[model samples]
Target: MPIHEKSLIRKENLVENESLVIDGVDVSGHWSTFITGRSLTDYNDDMQDEIAALPGGENIHRCWQCGSCTNACTVNAVNPEFNPRYWIYLIRLGMEEELLRDKDIIWQCVSCNKCTYACPRDVVPEGVMKATAHWLELKGHTPKSPSTEFDEEFSGQVIKTGKIEESRVIMNFFRRTEQPLAQPWLVALIKGLAFRFPVFYLMRMGMAVVRRPRTRNWAKSRRAINEYVQEVEAANRAAVGAKGGH
Candidate 1:
């Protein structure tokens, strides 16, 4: 028989073939079915360096994008565009611009940690959300964040009065965010005031948040976060040492 000619294949097809053969048969790699694509720069110096600087960011590489993070995320189930898997992949590719452009989605994360609980690899998507949130804040690009207006108005209220007065927070949050306090329910406000309502709705929650008494453990909470960041720094140092590269 004549020797058969080798068929030419695209690089992606070859990678897909290799990936299929490598671990697609395994139970743990089941999510490999969802790989829309993978990038060439899976890991880069700047990405590794950036992770090294962030608290609790050592295991960013541990994420295999199984979608456990996204599936477990409360926000993603409702908002498909708020994807943790894709952002983690972007970080791995040193796509800092893409990540920066995604501040709104990144900051929308409530950090409830359902994703971390679901992640088999302990990737802690919640932690990554916080680190990225801090990163955006440092870049002075947080104005577009969903919670920015509420946070700013709350801070201003606190600074002015050394305390946040409840009703003021509610009104300021609504005005600053340009949120209509009520639409068809405009009559509901008058009803709530007439009835002395027990709780608030939507953007007005800030009012309730400030009126709550400061906790006795408030100082302890602050100290705990400081120590936690230090520990994360230590862990990052160890991770960088083990890798032995920038």
Candidate 2:
């Protein structure tokens, strides 16, 4: 469906004449308002396909502009500009330029899944939002979000050793994100754990940290998982025509 919502129209695109006369009839103020015509020349025909290639974006083709997703979106409730339905409409039409207008806020999805539940076509609107955010990052339109950074750290730990060290993951994430390790909450939590845990348990935790233990016989599984991850990364880059690493 074509976008007819006045709120969706960009402010610059809406023209208003305080004093105007058309065909010998005075049409002033809001009566003289007109929306500027838009002509798109930089459409990326492969946008929808590229998004579909990513995880959680496979069902984008099922969207029918039902508007249910936006209605149920948690972020949209607070910020109307965060409209999933409109973004999906732009994506389906390959309106890359239009989609980029909201690049900054697209990653604000809270992943509440309300949109997914409200979508009648099983479009999984929440997933589409995530995929769109990923696309923006991959396309160099936006920086990596904090959540993405944390996900990388967490996933890297699991993939490397087939197990994760919570303290290591948090520290690495904070380091990568340039966050200081001495936050008040973190210090308090560490102190609480140190005092509450038994002496032997604390010692064991310290030993695990120093040793960086891995799952038994995890080398072979690590290799297989690494190969699969590489393959998927290659596919994702090929799909979006992204060059170099994010």
Candidate 3:
């Protein structure tokens, strides 16, 4: 028998004997490979309902496993393990343990919306990816992901100033994630851009970092938005059984 997901198999389950005899015939090497049998009884029957209650997960029930989302997913093209269709199937079936195997990479979705556009059932797989990542964090299955920290940093700036300073957002994100500002790849990219467009690059950086940008008379709008954001956060927490506020 072939396993649909080899990752789900434990290493100890595999048995291999180089020299063996069965029924007076030699059976070794590839033929000697055998997998131990086991049963899963710990299924979270409510997992699907819990995920569906979260934002962006509402349409999960609409999926028919057509696989269009995975076919059009940009991330899936580069990483075969990033299969949105498979994850959706696992979620619908309440295969919580199986889904957790890919938790670390679920947040890697770039929100390109290609999956959503190609989905015949309008599953909005991009949204489901976000929702799943959030669910993982909220349920304490995993710590707050780097993507979540970056999003909070970026959104906080936008909510407060009615705009965002790109440099500030990046710096804040790096700080929260405890990453060095002078990362090799980032430094190289910046150097390349500066070399190609010295004047424009320096001017843009100066504006984004030195002077900064803010909306005029945005205090009132900011207050209103902040209040709304708090309400939404509380509602989400209640739905997921998390604390009322961040």
Candidate 4:
């Protein structure tokens, strides 16, 4: 059997038969394949507004379909399926189903800011990616991805102490994602660094673990940030048709 252009067709929509005979005739080839068509009934008309209500999604409406975001995306270069411009178009058209197809990989963005730098309208594709990923988890469309878990762990430390302990953040991220703390590559890197600069590495590690640094007189600032975060979260939930958030 010959191959067909099945990239544009959804898996469930395609039918194939390598060798088949229909009645008294043979129809065993790529020509015997079928592609089902589907139509969406309801559209989440408020999708753009709901996403824009989030912190990083505020500029999504400014996109003019220049495709710069997708062209400059670091992830898109490796996985063409990770398209920020296409997702923005889907959001603009309220094509929720199409957007959901790429939901799982949306959180894989590395925050390299290449898309943001290349954007002519300042769409900030990085922020839109983060907002979309957050929305997916919030709406139960997907589970908390490893990247999301890492963000929460890092952010939690900063929110609590006004500073982050790198070792603690890494450990907590691995724990939350159920990954082993002693990753082979990470262990190798640490060993290499220690071997090159034993005294410097040991002193730095001890200070980071034992005497964690923090901002001085940060209680008032922390309280202010917490209150602001809560307010924004509540607003975002309400905008997205969710009831409440902590």
The per-model lDDT (C-alpha) reads 0.64, 0.89, 0.87, 0.87
In model 4, what is the error at residue 211, expressed in angstroms? 1.2
What are the candidates' C-alpha RMSDs? Answer: 12.0, 3.8, 3.4, 3.6
Candidate 3, position 175, lDDT: 96
lDDT of 1: 0.64
- Model 4 spans with C-alpha error above 4 angstroms: 1-4, 14-35, 196-200, 244-246
Q: Order of candidates by TM-score, top first?
A: 4, 3, 2, 1
The lDDT leader among the candidates is: 2
| Alpha-carbon runs more than 4 Å astray in model 1 | 1-48, 51-58, 140-144, 152-165, 178-190, 193-246
Please give, for residues 1-246, the per-residue lDDT of candidate 4 as tens digits: 333668776778887788888786788877678775567877889888888888799999999999998998899999999999999999988999889988889999999999999999998999998888888877878998998788788888898889998888988888888889889999999999999999999999988988987888989989999999888788778778876552
lDDT for each residue of candidate 3 in 1-246, tens digit (9 for 90 to 100): 234455676777877778888898788765767787679788878777778887899899999999999999999999999999999999998899899999999999999999999999888899899989988888888888998999999999998888998889989899999999999999999999999999999998887777768898999999999999888777777778887444
lDDT, model 2, position 116: 89
Residue-wise C-alpha lDDT for candidate 2, range 1-246, written one tens digit per residue? 123576877789988888888898888877777888878888889999999989889999999998999998899989989999999999999999889989999989999999989999999988999999999999898999988898899999888898898878988999999999999997898788778876976898789789996898888998999999898888888889999776
Worst 10 residues of 4 by lDDT: 1-10
**TM-score quality measure for candidate 3:** 0.83
